[model samples]
Target: MTTDPRTLIWSKSSYSGNGGSCVEWAPAQTTTGIVPVRDSKNPDGPVLSVPTRSFAEFIAGVKSGAFFAA
Candidate 1:
């Protein structure tokens, strides 16, 4: 499914408080089962379209700290 990133509303994580390192996602566009993600610092940058289930798994991993160094 092709989507115009400019038409999507992006929202950043609340946990990103005062951090320059932040990412944004378009929940509105996720209705089609595709999650659009982009750097909050670079709105005009490239956008990544990930499957809804895959994005959910990725979020779970983050909450589980699976991405942190062991």
Candidate 2:
């Protein structure tokens, strides 16, 4: 059974459109414990589904500047 990703409502990230660092996420459908992420640049591209816990960790890291360049 294949699921259509278009049916999912995506929201633009806060960092979107800033220095080409944009990302979109499907949070409403994340009730299933998996978060869907796709490039804001290419909506028709393949999606990356990460576990909710992992997504949270990644977000926390972003907030904490864990992935920021020195």
Candidate 3:
């Protein structure tokens, strides 16, 4: 990660709540074949870059509630 960063226009996920369950992604970055994800409260922190395909899968899992165990 460089101190001089690349541009990222992050948009919060719809699932985010006011209690601070926030997750943001850059749709523009994903168009370049990489997805940048970071905490909405920590914009200057580390960013996780994922392939577009993997990002889609992760989103699908989230919508399907696969991350929450019964």
Candidate 4:
């Protein structure tokens, strides 16, 4: 079954804080091996569908501070 990205329930990280810069992802869509992501500041913007494994790796990188400013 295919689900519409717009109709999927999206979520933001709890660690996102109150910052306006945050991305939302549809966790429910992960069951299909793909996750739909969109900018919280621009809900109507384009959606990026990433593979579940790739998305998990990205999350791991974030948690490990791999993207932290030098």
- Clash total of candidate 4: 0
Q: Predict model 2's lDDT versus the native.
A: 0.85
What would the per-residue lDDT of candidate 3 be over residues 1-70, giving only the tens digit for each residue? 2222247567999988886768888887766788888888787887888889999999999888889845
User: In candidate 1, what are the lDDT values of residues 19-68, reduced to their tens digit?
Assistant: 56788999988889999998988899999999999999999999998897
TM-score for each model: 0.86, 0.87, 0.81, 0.84
Q: Tell me the tens digit of each residue's lDDT in model 4 across 14-42.
A: 66668656889888888899989888878
- Residue 49, candidate 2: C-alpha displacement in angstroms: 0.5
Reference-based lDDT, each prediction = 0.88, 0.85, 0.78, 0.84
Model 2, span 1-70: residue lDDT tens: 0357788899989887665967999998678888889998899998898889999999999999889666
User: Candidate 1, clashing residue pairs?
Assistant: none
Candidate maximizing lDDT: 1
Q: Residue 31 of candidate 2: its Cα lDDT?
A: 86
- Candidates sorted by lDDT, descending order? 1, 2, 4, 3
Greater-lDDT candidate between 2 and 4 = 2
Residue 32's lDDT in candidate 3 = 74
Candidate with maximal TM-score: 2
